[model samples]
Target: MTTRHDLQTRLERGIAALGLQLPAGAVERLLDYQALLARWNATYNLTAIRDPGEMVSRHLVDSLAILPYVQGATLADLGTGPGLPGIPIAIATPEREVLLVDSNGKKVRFLREAIRSLKLENVRAVQSRVEEVEGQFDCVTARAFASLADMLAWGGHLLTKSGIWLAMKGKHPEDELAGVPDGYEVRAIHELHVPDVGGERHLVVLGRTGC
Candidate 1:
């Protein structure tokens, strides 16, 4: 088993390579959060990706890829299973309020426990469908939850009139872009470079053009 210290070292290295200017003690908190996730994943199977090192790359780094594109003071991560992107963003950007939305009860339980254990004051895990989630946020994010059109259709209401949505994908979603609804437009598809990981990773930035 990889010791916690070893995982911390790898995470620190990965964070440094990623060039993220995290808040004080954010790294430690992230490690703690990862530990909790691993513990819960053993039986609950929160995520498919195992291995602490890979978690640092796939989970931590993949989530951090949107840091540069994050807009505004509040963000809602729709279909945020196990608090990907949202939880890490909350730990890194303590100023931004992050809400993780997912309908899965087990996942929500894990998210709540993670929030409590990490002592993250800025993150809240809500058990609700994306379409039913209330409030408009400055930014919204989802990870391959559904088609771009479907994603916007269901969660678009959560985004402010001029807010942005950063959708994480493993490859460029050309097919998904064909039907991006009416009010939303593709601003730019950013190709993310996550350290210690290979293959394609992109953050599709979708901005609302109308109210």
Candidate 2:
């Protein structure tokens, strides 16, 4: 059984390793969100990673690892299963307006509960498919949701002209690069080193052509 203190220690070390200075009390709120997810996950089966320690590393810190790449004031997380990255991002940066979209009702319900329990003022959860979601955002994030082409095809319209798309993927995704849609171009690919995570993590940054 992993204690909350143990989880906090791990999270603190991970954040320090990532070189992030999160807002005051952000760490505690992130843990609060994690605890909420764990409680709901036991009944709802929201995520496969069960152990609290692994949750601290793979879910919380793994999400925060991409914080430096995240830009703009508004962000939409498509196919945000159980609010991975989105919820943590929201907790870390309360000033950024975040929208977590997912087709799964249970996951969306859990997101709403997290927002309420965490007192997140700048977050919203919408139960909708990626293509049906409305509005434009300054940043769009998709975490291992779909291929590069398919993700842009569905959610490309949500990104503002100057906005960037942060696509999180495991491994390099070499095969998917050629499939990027016509208008969007791969701006950069960053190799992320998440503390305590055993697998390779990559963040593919995309933007409109000539932007």
Candidate 3:
């Protein structure tokens, strides 16, 4: 049985390995979010990963790894099932406004509950398809939600002209690079090193051409 203490230790270690300086109480808040997710996941099947330790590494730490690359004050997480990266980012940066968008009603419900329970003043959850979502953000994030081309086609309009799109992938998406739509270009590709997680992790940064 994984106690909350055990999960906290795992998360602390992972955060330390990532060299991240979270806000005071941020670590505990992250663990609280994970615990909430674990409980809800049992009934709603929000995520596939079942192990608590794995959740700390794969979900919490993996999401935080991109914190350094995250830019802008406003962000929209598209297809954010159960608020992966979005919720965690909101918790880490309380000042940044985070919008979590997902088409799944259940997931959005979970997100709302999370927001209420976590006291996340900077986060909001909406149940809507990416294409239907309104308003632009300074930064947009999509985690393994779709192919690069499809994601851009659906949610590209949400990114400001000078904003960036951070796409998380398991491995370097070399083949998908060619499919990037015109007027958008790859700014940089970073190989993220997520602590205690196996397999390759890559963050593909995209933005408007010449921006």
Q: Best candidate, lDDT-wise? A: 2
Query: Mind giving the per-residue lDDT tens digits that candidate 1 earns over 153-173?
Result: 899899888899998998899
Q: What is the C-alpha lDDT profile of model 3 across 30-114, one tens digit per residue?
A: 9999999999999999999989999999999999999998999999999999898899899999999999999999999999999
Residue ranges of candidate 2 with Cα displaced over 4 Å:
none
Which residue pairs show collisions in model 3? none
lDDT of 3: 0.94
lDDT of 2 by residue, 46-117 (tens): 999999999999999999999999999999999999998899999889999999999999999999999988
Candidate 1, position 168, lDDT:
90
lDDT of 3 at 47: 98
| Order of the predicted models by TM-score, top scorer first | 2, 3, 1
Cα-based lDDT for every prediction: 0.88, 0.95, 0.94
